[model samples]
Target: MVTLELKGLHRVRSKGRVYWYAWRGGPRVLGEPGTPEFVASYNQAIDSVTTPDNSRFRSLVALYKASPDYKKLAHSTRRNWGPWLDRIADHFGELRIAQFDRPERIRPIIRQWRAKYAEKPRTADYGMQVLSRVLSYAVDPLGKIASNPCEGIKQIYNHSDNDRSEIIWTDGDIAHLKKTCSVEIAHAIDLAAHTGLRAGDLLRLSWSHVGEDAIVIPTGKSGRRREAIIPLYQELRDVLARIPKRSPVILTHSKKGPWAPGSLTKAFDTAKEEAWSKGDNLHFHDLRGTAATKFYLAGLTAREIAEIMAWEENTVERIIRRYVGRGAAIKEKIRRLNEVRSRT
Candidate 1:
């Protein structure tokens, strides 16, 4: 008989035959000793065993962080996830993955986090989403848990409740913003209003992206490598012509080469405060919605707007419905009817 000394391997005799068990609990059978099959099974079992410390939530998050799926996220998305993941690890690091097999155990923790940021429900919801994704990863390829605990829980944040009607910017508001802000800030507001580019895309825009008639973006928030083309309107072109390109990026600070995201936000907030002192609820992002409304009024189809803005058609339609309303469509129909009557 060959004496085999493997940590998880056990020798058992049954029905006048000798068998090797991979683990004592599950008792998965390895092949007979000294056989090629037995060696391969033993090696696989050894590799599959998870140490006590490796089964914790912290360990699972570390595994997810190293995964290709996580690495493939956009730079902004990865940066956003960092703090949320850190908070999740701080709350649930010591807990073993198997402990989250029951949904009841995880619900209270999620609710508590949601309550902590009640005023910012969207942000709270985002944290829950990140945790749910991590748990999903644990259930699948990792096999750490049997199922996702966050599967059936309803999202606590109400999109309609938090939706601010005041985000829509008017022509007067845009003119006021231009007057109050510096030349660089004014150009950013105009570009966002004209092109519907997100603040991140605007900050990352380089002179190399500009073409004779269009600005080509190699990548945006979407994970895919598809390029988005935004035509350069005459107004936007004139703004670009006025500004001298001192650095590689089109948007820059007076002294700093490129505007950092936080700095740009702070500057916009100051300008917004100065522009609209009373009942000012506008945000820098609202300018993108303003541009979407303009596109609809200019007779551009939702599909065309979606391609230029790098948004889904459904999203563009929703923005138009929210901002333009049915009144705009009715007014256009009335004007066309009057024009036809005059022609006849």
Candidate 2:
């Protein structure tokens, strides 16, 4: 039951049962540790010449994946991290984990691996993040190493104002994209713009979640750590009413079934390509900020927007500053200034 407490132990779950190994691809231990059979199998596996010469990374990856920590990741986070975990195994599978104890020895290896994606700084940073997590798990719960070589490794990607990340969808952009996308996807875009929900949360939104005066649900990004109660403003309600409630899940695919993340993304990309010959490269996520701006203009304070969007007040402030045009901001400021002058 507690076999994981031992070093090099790997666990696999299938059909509601767990099987134990001395190390992944090393030797299959028959039963729980401390049993005579388990002890014998484990000792034999550790000592056997037939046991393949192995890098512990694969086994470590297996152990980490089996943990509750990995299981609890946001659906999107797990989806993104999965491919990187596979890549980590493929790239670093040959290295013995004991080498990590000497930070000087392993730092160059991580750096060299990271160097391959220098042109794509974000991708490089993400890969290192997954790799570093695996190594850290190996150090603590697995007891395989004393330290993570990835500790203090600097990330190359830095946020900047000039980045395309600041670009938001204009009304014209929305109209063009809606014209190109399927009715369902267009409806999804409208919902995202109104409620500022992530694509995953948007797809999962349903009739039961719609209350008399609000759309209430936990967000996918926070993994249910927070709930967003979006007031049923006429604008958001109007967008919701445009889509029919045929499925328990909103945002169906190909006129039926739930919209999976991949299918939805593919449809969105196709729409973007068809919508513009050379358009602004904005993501669906940018619509969140668009919604934030909408809320700010409608007299919702930053704290209110933060609560409804399940975002930080600081983030709400940034979005209000970023997405609201300069002229609009100045005009709004003047309007507020006049209101105070009238009061005085």
Candidate 3:
């Protein structure tokens, strides 16, 4: 049996009532009568209110803002997650969280979204992740719904072993782009391909980071300082040498500051469009993939690739094995070249 009192109830100062019931928990209101079943229902409603709903989406946003870790997430990650939450809220409309405990209710909504918008598996997977995070904090303390409803729901992602659509600029492609692309975009592309720096890292690079024989990245994605030695590639050297050193930033449009992330992406987009005709869609990150793949094909070990590219060792191994191949053909070519010339 259980009982609840209502202290804030209308027309009463303080009153209490007892009723038959089970376990007891939740906010106490003196002078109100609540049976165990009623109390459980009320607590469930309150839990629903705390989770992502039409009204509670604002609260959830407030909670995220109030968290000290809000500033710790990467700027790009925060930006991506922000709009994703808005989309999820829009999909749910005014549905309460408790109402979503059943998969049937959620499954229709997901199917509807899939039907309306032909979202690829990768995009759908990202949406699922964002939804899961929103409800992660709303789990019941009694271990009834110990985790969010979205917990452990596997996302179906597309994988391919023979996807040769990667934008690996051949020697000819680079030559054509250099001859045609603008000076600024060309320099950015050169930095991306040769140094294996992310677009963000390149934009944030400073003259102080560039030394005589190498480009030093003071802060990589892993928050480690790494120095990538400049290769003997003449075109790469020419690109860096041509850029006038005016500001502290190595790749800056104005002396005030480096290009914003959006601005850089926009510039790269324009240059990429000009560099490739139709049927070739490439993104800036593909440059890193190309460089890493080339290095693996050149017989560099995963550890060596990690040091050069400032990536974790596992990442280097994964990228090489996934994108670049086993390198057996390249190795065979090297072996054949090392052999003595055949006599007539």
Best by lDDT: 2
Name the runs in model 2 displaced over 4 angstroms.
1-43, 46-63, 86-106, 134-152, 158-162, 178-182, 253-257, 312-342
Report the error of model 2 at residue 263, Å.
2.8
lDDT of 1 by residue, 102-174 (tens): 7788777767766887787678779889998899999898888889888887777886875753366678988
* Number of backbone-clashing residue pairs for each candidate, in the order shown: 0, 0, 11
RMSD to truth, every model: 8.2, 9.7, 9.2
* TM-score ranking, high to low: 1, 2, 3
CA-RMSD of model 3: 9.2
After best superposition, candidate 3 residue 53: deviation in angstroms?
Answer: 11
lDDT of 3: 0.61
Clashing pairs in 2: none
Model 1: clashing residue pairs? none
lDDT of 2 by residue, 1-344 (tens): 34345678887899998788888887789966678888788878877753434455666777778888788788778989999998887887767767777899889988999999999998999999998898888888778888888999988998673454346677888998877678988888899889888777887888899999999999888877788899999988888888887899877877578987667877887788888767557877788767766776677777898899888666777756776555556766787899999999
Off by over 4 Å in 3: 1-70, 87-122, 134-166, 211-214, 218-239, 253-260, 275-279, 297-299, 322-344
Cα lDDT, model 3, residue 297:
62
Candidate lDDT values, in order = 0.78, 0.80, 0.61
True-vs-predicted CA distance for residue 220, candidate 3, Å: 7.3
TM-score of 2: 0.69
Candidate rank order under lDDT: 2, 1, 3
